[model samples]
Target chain A: MHTAEVLASRLGLDIAVAELERLFSQPGADPPDYGLDGGHRRPIRVAYQGVRGSYCHEAATTSFPSAAAVEAFPSGFWMEDAFSTLESGSADRAIIPAENSLDGPIDRNLDLLLRHPAVRITGELVVPVNHCLLAAPGVEISDLRRIVSHPQALGHCERRLQSLDLEVEEVDDAAEAARAVAEDRIRDTAVIGSRIAAKEFGLRIMEQSIHDEGGNYNRFLQLGVGDGPLYCGENRKTTVAFSLEKGVSGLFRALWVFESRGIRVTKVDHRPNRANPVRLVNRAGGVELAQMDYVFVVDVEGSELDPRVAAAVAGLGEFSGFVRVLGSYACTCGA
Target chain B: MHTAEVLASRLGLDIAVAELERLFSQPGADPPDYGLDGGHRRPIRVAYQGVRGSYCHEAATTSFPSAAAVEAFPSGFWMEDAFSTLESGSADRAIIPAENSLDGPIDRNLDLLLRHPAVRITGELVVPVNHCLLAAPGVEISDLRRIVSHPQALGHCERRLQSLDLEVEEVDDAAEAARAVAEDRIRDTAVIGSRIAAKEFGLRIMEQSIHDEGGNYNRFLQLGVGDGPLYCGENRKTTVAFSLEKGVSGLFRALWVFESRGIRVTKVDHRPNRANPVRLVNRAGGVELAQMDYVFVVDVEGSELDPRVAAAVAGLGEFSGFVRVLGSYACTCGA
Candidate 1:
């Protein structure tokens, strides 16, 4: 009867009418299967840090067209491996969670961008962070004794899980938890992961979107291995990381370069220059030493071709840490 | 005989030495409550979001030299009221959780910062997050029918809480749970909050840190009405929020303002821009229109007085949505 139901029926997309009710019961909620969009243009081999049906995987599907062959990694550390796959002749691109709507920035991802100067911000995909309580086929709610998932997933599902009165367990990832259930590690075990994982792994959706805080979305970055596509009519975004030298006013002098140069910084963020700490002196003549890690990210609106932007960064003296230029790309989704 | 016993006596302060080891121990892998710096600070008026002896009050006492008055706010929002009071002639300053190392950023507090731009960041404090299952004086875990606390607090104690095998209820805060027992609202109900709440409100510590994740420390922000000590020494830090206008290209443009200016950023993070959504446009077409609201939070190496820092920001132009100079206090502790 619903338009989405008709679309689902025609597309042969495995969308259940009842499941749609659960995820979209709230007003303004969109259907899970965004169906196929001409926007993606081509098939994208997305590299995420988890197994199939994970939230990352779901996000990748939304960002790309036909994620037929997904390359998976065990931890975030392997994202570079995936990125390398994109860089070399293996994969097309990678999908990495730059930040979470609920949890702030994923620090490791930020560190990865800083450490690996090659990856550039091509485009971003925002995915709703909806998680569900899943159980294997034939199992019912009464059969569940323990619930497992990533810690945050567990946190999100706490209220619903508590209502079920099941034992809670912590796992490395939601997909892994589902995998555990598939292997029949414990008949009473259930996992809090994506509904897609539930469907892929043949787990029933016991519950969904248990997070008390609504409007959860994850901003994912699409990284191009090489110099990305030039901007046309599309919106654009650029990302970079830099830092200052150490001294009585070293950092102060460093910042003055930007203001003097006449550049508008859209985003400026930092991560400990994992490389080093700085020495600081206090009023009490207390000398405390710390290897200062450099601040690593900055973004803005404009073209690198702008002479002012180029001259500004050059003016800063010897940066004690890294100063990198990531990349600039056109935003595909036109607002 | 023990370190706490010796320290309590030496401090010349009224420190109620509880058996922390015994107090924090659990039946199978309960969390540890590495006693915080509380019970050591010089007496002062420390405001908290709960009744006397609440965990926050405990944190406040530890923060000061000798806390003379432990002011209790009904909720965290009231703590904001208290911060306003400190500004409008009531309290001096207040410490609030910005993030938990284990759980993640205290998003609510960050949201608060976005609203109350006047609050300045004084310094950062680290407090070990400990969640305990508490019961009334005469009751035990087995007699408990329901466990209650703020949602995240309950999640931290999820595993231990699951093990208790009791029903769960949601409450406003930890001390409220303690107050539940103190007021005799639920005779057999168990509260999962802080150990300080148990002792302060005369409840029993049924179990310790229920959170499965062990490395838990909440990052507390000391906020005041106006400018704090400007020069944060070695570990000196600054917090500011900004936004970008359209047509941003190359992160270099953004970084040029900072890197060229010599002002180093320590952390760069993104928040949803509630006012303006990130515009996405494709050459042909892709996803529909969207406007995202976001705020960029940055931590610099020094005070705003740093000329380079000011110039860089000036260059940042209209791309910056807002600029709130948090504070210029140096960290007394070595990074």
Candidate 2:
């Protein structure tokens, strides 16, 4: 065996890699038979939002290295288009950003995930974010007058950019910014993006790891079409989106179900209710007023199909205004 | 009373303005007396980040219209500096953006609020966000090559900007962008900011209300030096920041305190634990792993001083890992 394979086996990570490669491959031309040992027989086509050098592309490749093809779909700067690729059957799976360590949750993507009932998260890839300042050949860091990248990227490196005293511009994504700088050859400009992008665009690296802090990471979710696969043997994490009924005790009751079963929650986030932005509540003063509505998203340490977890989730129907399982996948904690 | 005064009185907004104006006046000539009614006697001195025409300035002026001076502090494009002005006794109170309707919680501000224990949230201001396209004299929309504003602002108007086909730039704030355009006489650039900024910067309103949604709004918080004054006697909102014990039922127990008393929670947000980013736990398989640590921030209806609310809060000290009352003030619901 190769040195890498030896290391993987020694670390007990070989099963994870093998499982990911096998599960991500395209479903065979024949209908899937769950009872069969290994389901898919053909290579899978994985879709990502940006061009080849984007973070999503890198995540897709890393997650499914054995896939036949990794396709790039222009999302018009919106992640929903990437999901549509999976929905329309053009790609077997889609990878997209779910959260960032420095930037918190990508609210837009979470909202889209909640809206698209057909797509379910199957796995997660946590990519260490290492941003570099890329510029044209022969360009030096001090030579750049302006820098451009996604707004989040600029914000992440706010202190460093302020120190450099360069005018910053915003674009749809870091890869797109790299592409723009390369095509236009803006001599006085640099782009903050992945090293892969710098190599792809033939640009010199002005600086590496320019973000405010090291160890910053972005978590991307692998989404597949349909409900979910059992995958019950391994430890798992389940994601569920829920909305509370119109009562002070609604949220408390919903959380109780999980706690009652000794399940631990990993994260919790709530967003404004898009369909009903506001609800009318009658105050003690006998006045009806408009208050914001919201939907809560939670991730917990267990599989939705597990009997204990299922019983807890079924309890949600008793008090929750709405609840749906986003996905259940093998736990990749500390990976 | 004058027509405007009569309208303000009828709307019951006069007290808020009067209290704000009274509380801010002498950026701090004396140590604050928590028990004193109408704490400060002179016209208030308020501080906000960004230049004159920025949203923070607008919020400050709108919240305390009768203040002696609304000072703009250059925070190096960071909100923490504005908080420091209050910490150093230079500004009586600092008004800053806390959250937005479209963008969810302003994560940076939330993190700042968590870190600064001396600064307490005293009140909140909800400002309707109306972004305008500002340009130099005689400049038209068609003449623009680039548009500039805060990243969040740019994202909010993404569709409109895409159709305009202008190179988008990121600046510290919209007002700063407007100032730059006015100073440089950049005929090929326009700024997306408030109409107030256009007037303040000697720029023409090339277009008004260019944001994708008209109902877009941002929530700003009023920060004061210490815990809170006894603003008892009305329907009120209490903001609290706390960290739960490392037990599965810790969060559920905390929420139980509020629900048991029939209090309603309006908002809930949790941020990663800054001091302790992660904790190592031994799983059932006897494997040690890293798990994220979080601090929960919650806003509930009813004053912190209310007997029932006080009882619930007191209960937290017994089971919570850590608990702190951010502040309590009259509820500004529908304001």
Candidate 3:
């Protein structure tokens, strides 16, 4: 049994055992999930978005419990700063939220990842979200006329907020929302955030676990500099983004590059090409029409170091307009 | 020249001409970009999210200007109500935003479209988004300490908001934000929304065309019921969702169906399978691992009425774990 499985069994968490087993089956693919104490010579510095009580901070902690330091960056344009920190040798690694189990992918982060070629994904972490409704001292639920929190947290507690008949508003961060309620003496408002946020801001916990779903989780990725495709250790997973050449069979031919190699693709996402958003072609007739130019982001099992994976990517270059390797990372199992 | 192109050339709008040409090339696939007065039998009833000055309202107007009634549904869970309105026979059709030029796909609407099989897309409309900064009569840019609007609108004007150094807040709708500012008489805040929203709320337009990009646009789909794959008039495009069977080449085989039929695929998007998010399978060494299950949403250039397209969709049954045709629609082009 793998360490993650053992931890899952011990904690009675609903982690995917079989997935974790496959991920760890590679000779050196095992992740240091418990802590970073065993593998590295020196402590690692990691950067995450928001203040101490933010989920990004929690995710950074969950990814590297014994790191040298966990640094917090401001939210606005912080993803770029986090990547820049890694590139400038200020931080060893950075963690960014990729998607939420309930809400799906985060658009801004996805766009940032696509734009930043310097950073590569090295690992992933899934953090279970538990939202608590916090209020000022001596204020009850009925006294709250409006609710404030991060957009995602507000979305997570949509039902709870609706039931409370509170006007929902969104702020930059949930922790900041709690701080505002505490510092501004806003008695008519409540904030939905982590219990740590309530404690940090000295606010009362009006309600606990107010999220609509109890098993909701957010997936965060560990990003570092350059193409360290070998970071997956024994278990090899590679992520690549590419655009297909112009032809009727262009999309199919591109997918064939991996399918013919017996490589299993885990996910595929398409984004419009920013530089040339629309493709125009002259048909046999004199008709001019607009076509779409899209870049496909795909995850496949096998490290870029593997000859088969390298050949498959090379094969993609034959028919792809643009091909880029995003990263190779060992899959971290979670519910 | 198509009506949309004429309107675009007249307004000097940044609509994608080539795409519009291809879309209209189909004998009956042309959409009335200016108004719905040309083809309809009687005054159509349209339903959209938010109040009169909202984007949804604008999309509905662009779709059908001579509608009998354009009804507004609450922003939260509005898509469901829009579909329900169509399903319950309260409205003739509903239009929902599918994707934005600047932002990626709207996940909630995508999921809703996938979930609700009762509604089928008959046509599509692309509306340019012109974001304006609105405030009270006496308020100026320097006087604003905070700004409130819809999340997407806020995101569109991120650079402008950052430069102003205002406390950004998000409400359910951009129009609602304008209304809130007008009703609450918030002296130190502004709203980023449509000029129509400002007019509706009796607020002053502090700034015009404040979007980060000049050519921002959103694509909205026209939906009805009962698989009117034949509704495309002379132009026909089909949208289908399918999950590949458990095999290395399952995905490739599914795409081959369309490619072999000489059909051009316009777009492809993959979403995590909600029913079975993670798939566990046995590898060559009899070791079990967790794999992922995803459903692909694809757009192809032929209507279901086309025998080739029908055969291809039918062929999907051989290798797809699940398959569903979302709708067939005539495309309206925009950047």
Candidate 4:
């Protein structure tokens, strides 16, 4: 029997092997209206964390091309402010980078997702990151005595930066660094940022794609008001966060629920539960052991509307102490 | 039946309930000599990332009190340099923060562990982070107009700083920020750092424990040369990193191997496989789909010396494309 057939029989679902193959192969169909009203009434306002030329700005504009305006929050350090703006109805949508291919998850945003329960993921956008070395006009790379960029950007281009033998300064944002270089007209310094930043600050791109590795990408998420719209598509992803009631077996059982239904789990991230950071496990003698409590964020390849997916989530209640479905969104990577 | 009895029976291990209770209750037994030879021949040299009064420095000195010298790399951005210092035999051991109770994992160090295969973890240390607000000797808290510290430190004290209404400047390290504040004699600026930093720079503590949450802690890992020694203790943690050969089911199977062996998984972290960031899944008729490949780092509560652990790791070979046991260290969290 085919793998899907076995799964279907076990789950008592009538899904066919061909259907499963198609669902697994596609990169998510076009999503339904997600609270923007198809942009018919007015252009959607999107809030992003960074200056006008930062990567987040690029992601926002790229993902929502017809957005009325992409407002900037001061820095990545203040991502909460962006979420707050969206929650306050100042912005119809908010965009934030969920993870970078090289740097991994932007953790603060993940924490914010849990903190801001009213926000939901509406879509995903994958942007290829190409770091550019920008300097004042007519300033060559050899004339640079120092380099400045966000710490993560500097870290990404560490190998190339080391070879250049220049002093490195860490800044809050890459675009901000570009702005500083342009405003100061520092002949002895270059900044590592994006091409958009270079253009925005009227700086020359001395070198392009200076990062050490190729294929660097940042995955950005579009967020809207709670449960704005259900994404009805064959290729979909449902993100959920849950904490176990007790014991290590709970995690295994939780994963088993999805696995038994042939649901493909795309990603799993564990964060220390802020409210209950540590749990004291007590034995019969009252001796206590401290164990770190965790909030698990999992992404599985199925819409919440799917019968098998719904059944699996229901099954999770048996093992999970608390569960929250963050969103069921189209898997619109590279779109 | 007791939980241990049920677990032992399921796993076919002869461990007793009382013994299991002891194992589960203790932090970890005093670790065996881990190739330091009791520091008899020469004072053990330790390498850490950051300046003298940085948190990593405190963790190093606190964890290795008998070390002859604790050397500092430039900053956290140069953590790989610390690892390289260890790999090149310039340092006997290196210590780096693995995770913060609030900020989550120090991702670059986790990536370094996978990149540098020779460095093995020897022990773990937990340090309570009490961020102090320090200023010029005569400066009062009300006199401050700006705050300078590491980004993470600023983040930890965000709530307090917001109420103070001070401008925040993010530097690479908290100690570095303190140094700048002292050297520049910036009376208007206060820095958030450790008490050690304030003392090192001749600054006065304007406020103590200014972080938003009370139980802020950083978990540090003591790394030594490859396979230095086996930690024989009732409470132990074995960390391993692996990537699957094929489908998502492999991860489920990998976890099942440990769950079946009655080993409790304490932590699980996922990162993109650098060499193979994305895999192309192909079906019939040349239909292809791109999937992000991941490197999973997991910590299980058992030393590699245990037969059950050995069997579980052996079982991983059946499902994993690549696997490496990073370390089997004593679970000495508080110590």
Candidate 5:
């Protein structure tokens, strides 16, 4: 038996490299069937934002390493497209970027998750970004004129690229930028992007480990298309998005939901509300045009199935727009 | 009316030109007191991490703009020293940068804020940054051998600085960088800093508006030595810091506190929980070292006095190792 397979078995997990390879290579292979008291359980297909070379792809791979093949989406907006795919019996799970260590929170994605309240937290992936500067093979630094990459990758490598004295142009994604450098449109130009992008687009690595910190990482969430997992590790985490109702004291009352129990929270983020539109309405009409309800993303300790978590979700329904749970999953504490 | 004062009154906020004038003058004055409650509330002093000519100084001026005055510290760490001052009744508040639009969150400051629970968010200041490359009179880019500034300032102007072929030296803040240029210890050394620092040190403008985004701004939070005002406007926001209790599910249950309340949070940041130090017991006993807890900084829409907020806080108490109200105040919202 392989070491990885042995480790997986010792941990009581059904993961093996060969199993994962087969799952991804298969076409809509039915996942393991687990019979519930009511009926047969349906396996899920998940979607996420980003190109093939994006770290998010790695996150999706981590979620069900040995399960049936799942579908992937191109962008976060397409995750909504995945929702339609799920409705059409194609995908059942959607993964999203909820927060990051350096970036703080992914507010826009939170809005998307809240817009789709049916999704639940099933698992999570923490992907460390190892950004690499890439160029055409055998291309030297002094020969470069312009450096291109995603706007975010640009921000991450700003210091290093500025030192290289290259003209920095923003691109949609690092992988796309790598593709640009490969097309040979501009011989002297290079791309400030990811190693994944370089390896994917057949570009050469010019420099590696350019981020200001070596610990740059992002947290990806596995969002269930329906009710969440029934059981998870004791260290599981859950997410909920909410908006408060009236009464100056209602916010105070809401705190009782979790602190009333013993469950703890790990993180939270807030963004412009997507549900209730705030409009520049004529005072007499009070009409909604754009948005009114601002959403709050909360990450708490414990799975939704836990009694405390279940009670809190059910209890907090007194709110106006408290209608979303992004995901919940067990996490390794030490990592 | 003074230009800044005119801007303040037109903005319909507590902005005074006099406080700004004082800030530009001395090293030690009580930090400005932004009216926390209203026209009747006592003013709160703010301690910021920088001298007269730093972005933090500008942020402090905008938040308070009235008597008690402004106190400036030399480094970001000294802001904590100033926080110690607030803790010891030497200063009334501290304004620290929590995040920036371009560079992402200040991880160190977030970690610091989490460790210091006594300090609360009394108010917030949004300071527009127009970074410029400053140098000595008659100095040209060709003559420059080194560029110095805070890491953040260097980062802010990273793209524009390419091709200069100068060695980048990181300093504590813009003021220090300007000081270094003025002392002439490092000839041919220019500083990428603020106009305030440039003017204070009599440095010439080497480059104007070097930031990639013209409207780049940094978000600063005013932390008061005392509790927040008795009441706030209907549009006030509440801040809280918490650590999950041991064996707690972690982040999501705490989220349910707000999710159930119908309360919406505007921002949330994770800071290292310093209170829980790693304990080392004698090797014979094998007593486990204490694990570090993660601190969450949450800004929700509403005041602490709100019942929903009360319920949220109450509920949080059960799962939280520690939870405290940062503060609440009305501010200019995007709406």
Candidate 6:
């Protein structure tokens, strides 16, 4: 009997033994290829938004454990700066938070991905978020009158912060908020940030893991310039963005191409097409319908190099106004 | 010849005449029912985040032109407060921004919608966003050292603001930024906001329509307590949220039900399932896979009362762990 089945039986879990066997028998359980060449021509540098102790910085370091340097960009407000750094060849890879389990998609990065066509998503890292309330040393919880953090972090801990009854202030970065509290000696203000930020800024962690719920995770994507390498593996996931040629049945037909090919779609999202924002659909009664054009981004369970995936993309091109394969990378098994 | 055909031919547009005819022949182009009882029980009070000059305020007033009272909530940071007002019977309706053309989905409100099950979306309005640069009276543009506005406004005007080379500060609301500039007499800071905000706050318009690109719009949804009325119309659009019982072919099968029923899906989005955030998939080799669970939200081109839509939703329930019909309302044709 499989170890998983034994464990499930012991735990009285209703999971099927056949499903466990299938999952274990799946190939390509190896670590994902981040498209890094082995030769060390120069020290590898990864660029990420925010200062050294931010969650993004932690994502960068964790994604590239042995990287020689992790460069920090001052502005967390704009994700474009990180993309530009990668596009300009200043950094080997740029890591940006793509989505939060609680807050959903980090849209600014998604928009930047569409805008920067050359940048390819090479790998993804799912970091468990544990927001901490940090304040200056010698400050008690009762002394706090206000709380500060990034909008996403604040949102993650909204219920906790509301119970605290502190005035909430949003900044571009959680580490910046921690730095402000520490450097400015704001005894009355606490920041919702990471433990790393508290340690780096010499601030006391008043509360640890203060997020509203357990299992908070942030998915971060590692982006590299151009098409670096094709991931050849069974557990590969390909992301593509496309716009439909027709209105009503466009998306249905678009997804049909994959379904007919026996491809499994993992996720689907839509973003407004920045280049072609509107389409004027004129009617018989002179009623001009200005419809918002959308670019649908989908993730399928195969690499683009796979024959089936290639054929499915080619088929998508038939009915789509435009289709671009963003990237195909090995899927991470767990957070 | 139809007027649309004549206009298309004169403008040298490659639009098909048959398509135009079909569009015009489509039924139900009447204005939507806002769910107002048309009784004088009490002044129709609508609650929205931000003050009178904010975008949410504009969406509320525009959605209900004859609303006697528009209540302003102080906290624009949290969308939950606006929803709570409607849930607690403090307001008859609540209006909140759903999506922005350039910035994409307003995720906070989407998260709030999932949390507040009792609140139902009754109507929608697409407001054209015309952002302006506001500053203190008699303050020249050259004298400004910093710019302040809501994060979305700052993002929309990023390119224009980058060209100005001023420090940027993000506030909770654009109107609040304008108010700060006017009330505090901040001569060195300009704000990216609306003309309404400038007029209300007594700030001068430094520049008009300062957004980066044209066709800027914000889609707003009006929410009320419970399912007030079943929209019975040809142009009705229904929004639904569901979570699949299985993975892989789950979403495809879900969409297939709608497509087979001839229901046109207008939009698709995914939100993290807060109640059940993670699913533990155990494998034979003792590899435990913790996958993030998601709730899929879809908008289809029919009301729940429509038999076809109802049948499709029932079909969805067969394979869905959870299903919710958020609302059905008349479709807004243009921005």
Each candidate's fnat, listed in order, reads 0.12, 0.17, 0.16, 0.25, 0.12, 0.45
Q: What are the Cα lDDT values of the candidates?
A: 0.56, 0.69, 0.67, 0.71, 0.58, 0.71
What is the TM-score of each predicted model, taking all chains together? 0.51, 0.69, 0.69, 0.74, 0.49, 0.75
- Clashes in each model (backbone N, CA, C under 3 Å)? 75, 3, 14, 0, 70, 0
List ranges where model 1 is wrong by over 4 Å.
A1-45, A67-92, A138-146, A158-167, A185-189, A206-210, A246-264, A279-293, A302-322, A331-335, B1-335
- CAPRI level of candidate 1: incorrect
Best by DockQ: 6
Instruction: Give the per-residue lDDT of model 2 (tens digit) for B1-335.
Output: 57965664433423433355344322223323223233323334477766678877766666544434334454435788878888997776677877676666677777887778888877766556777888999997778899998898998788889999989999866787788889899999988887768777899998776888534767777787765355655456788778777743266667778877888666667776655544556666654444455677778888787888888888877877788888786534322
Cand. 1 TM to true fold? 0.51
DockQ of candidate 5 is: 0.07
TM-score for chain A as predicted in candidate 6:
0.79
Deviation in angstroms for A243 in model 3?
A: 3.3
Q: Candidate 5 docking: what grade? A: incorrect
Give the B-chain TM-score of model 5: 0.71
- Candidate 2, residue A276: Cα displacement in angstroms equals 2.4
Q: State which candidate has the highest TM-score.
A: 6
Note the residue pairs that clash in candidate 2: B24-B44, B25-B43, B25-B44
lDDT of 5 by residue, A8-110 (tens): 4433322222232233223134444333322222233456666765656556655554344344554444546645554454555556665554444565556
Lowest lDDT 10-mer window, candidate 5 chain B? B278-287
Regions more than 4 Å wrong, model 4: A1-40, A64-78, A130-214, A247-249, A282-289, B1-40, B64-77, B130-214, B247-249, B282-289
**Model 4 has how many clashing residue pairs?**
0
Summarize candidate 2's per-residue lDDT along A20-93 as a digit string, tens digits: 43443221222223221232232345677767678777666555543333334444346887888889877766
- A122-201 per-residue lDDT for model 4 (tens digits): 66666567789999999987788999889989988989998998999998777877887889888998988887788778
- Candidate 5, B261-301: lDDT as tens digits: 88875455565444442222121223222222357777687
The CA lDDT at B289 in model 5 is 20
